[model samples]
Target: MIKIVLLGAGNVATHLYKGFKKANTVNVVQWYNRNLKSIETYKNEVKITDNVNNLIEADVYIIAVNDDAIPELSSTLPFENRLVVHTSGSARLYDIDQKLYRGVFYPLQTFSKAVDLDFTTVPICIETLRKKDFKLLETLGQSLGCVTYKVNPKQRPALHLAAVFVNNFTNQIYRIAHEITEKQGAEFDILKPLITETARKVQEVSPYIAQTGPAKRNDKKTIKRHLKLLDNPDQEAIYKLMTESIKKTHGH
Candidate 1:
């Protein structure tokens, strides 16, 4: 079995622990966090600890904490030359302490502690210093049923930036739409089908080809009406900016 020591109790850590536990080929031997209470509930299943000195002997140590804490926390690892990896999309692999082996095991998916994720659907991106260590991580990734990709440091940052545009920025637009609907006393639920269809269309066709609406059609009247409906200055600015961008992209 590929034994793992999971560090942190945040969303990514929680989901990873559950996913790995379900995979017969991998064993999560221990879970550690500075705040013991955050990981205490997992004690029934795996050995849990707060002190770094109490960490168990394991094949791999996976850090799933905040990005800023990675360098400092990694420096404190009492052991050396082990396969230590961090679960961050944007952090440089060099950020880990040079005294020990370091790598990245970034899952290209948004994690939520309350949400159950299908490991098979998540894209596991990995990079390691040694070729042998890469095989070890690849084996672990495949065991979890993920589609693994050997992504390097230089390319990883670009992927992370694109993810922010597609996932984070798009979600913010959804929030803006929800607020607009709610302000007019309309049920946001009514837009559910439209939202789903919009997503589905982009999956089957290029986003440019799937694009529609007043901005795409260069309907000035509708654009002016939308701007007028948006009472908030910030909302109006965003709407106007996006409308202009769409027009420029489509040559409207």
Candidate 2:
């Protein structure tokens, strides 16, 4: 069995704790957070501690804290030469103390504590400094029924940047749409179907092929009308920028 000590109490950590619990081959031996109350509720299920010196021996220590906290936390771990991995999409693998076996087990998906996520659907990007450690990390990821990929340092950052465009930036645009709909006294729920269809289309075809709308067709009149409808300068600026980008992509 892969015995893991999970450290952190945020969204990623919470989800991973649940996923590991459901995996028969994995045992979350301990969970730690600087703020003990954040993870005190799980004390009945597993050992919980706030002191780094109190960490027990485990096969792997998974650090799921904020990107900035990774280096300091890894450095403070009482044990070394053990497998230590972080669940950050953008943080460097070497962010962990060199005294330990450093690696990354980034889940390439946005996680929210309230949202129900299926582990099988989340892709795990694995990277290890030592060649021998790769298989162990891969097995850990597989234990949760996640599809694992060997992503290098160079590629992982690029993948994270692309993810920001697709997930974070896309969500912001959705918020903008919601605001626009609210201004017109229209039901924002009416756009739900379009959102679903748009997401479904990209799975079956390239985004380029799935492209449509006035901007893609270079319909200047419609673009101008949209800009005029957006009274807020920030909203108008975003609309114009996205329209120009779409037009450029389609060679308009």
Candidate 3:
């Protein structure tokens, strides 16, 4: 069995625990968090401790803490020459103490504690200190039904930045649309089909090719009307900025 120790109790850590529970070949030997109460719920299910010194000997130690905390935590670990990884898309693998094996096991998906996600569709990006160690991570990813890829640490940052534009920025735009609809006393559900279709279209075609809107068409009159409709200066500015971006992208 692949014995593993998981550190942290945030969304990524919680989801990893749940996913590991379903894999028969994997064993969660222990869970560690700075605050005992944070992961107390799993006490009955597995060994839990708040002290890093109490960590058990395991095949791998997965640190799923914030990016900034990764360096300090990894440096403070009492063990050495053990397989240690962080679940951060942008964090440099070299940031982990040179005394230990460093790697990244970034799951490319947004995680929410209250939401259930199917691991099969998630892409698991792996990077390891030793080339041979990648096989173990690949096995772990496959066990969770994820599509795994060996990503270079240098390339990982660009991938993370692209994700921000597609996921984070797009979600914020959706929130703005929802607010606008609510202000007009309209049901946000009315735009659900359009949103769904937009997402679907991008899967079948390039986003550039799938683009369709007044901005894409360079309909200045319609653009002016949209800007006039939004009363908030912030919203109006965003509308104008996006329209200009679309026009620039399409070479209009």
Query: In model 3, where is the ten-residue run with the lowest total lDDT?
Result: 150-159
Among these predictions, the greatest lDDT belongs to: 2
What candidate 2 gets wrong by more than 4 Å, as runs, is none
lDDT of 2 by residue, 1-252 (tens): 999999999999999999999999999999999999999889999999999999999999999999999999999998779999998989999899999999999999999999999999999999998877889989989998999999899999999999999999999999989988998899999999999999999999999999999999999898888787888999888888888899999999
* Residue ranges of candidate 1 with Cα displaced over 4 Å: none
Candidate 1 at 230: error in angstroms? Answer: 0.6
lDDT of 3 by residue, 1-252 (tens): 889899999999999999999998899999999998988988999999988999999988999999999999999999999999999999999888899998899999999999998999899999997886799889988889999999996778888999999899999999999999999999999999999999888989999899889999999899988888999999898898999999999999
What clash pairs does model 3 have? none
lDDT (tens digit, per residue) of candidate 1 on 61-100: 9999999999999999998988899999999999999988
Q: Candidate 2 lDDT (Cα, whole model)? A: 0.94
Clashing pairs in 1: none
Which runs of model 3 end up more than 4 angstroms from their true locations? none
How many Å off is the CA of 170 in candidate 1? Answer: 1.4
Work out the TM-score per prediction.
0.97, 0.98, 0.98
* lDDT score of residue 146 within candidate 1: 96
- For candidate 3, the lDDT comes to 0.93
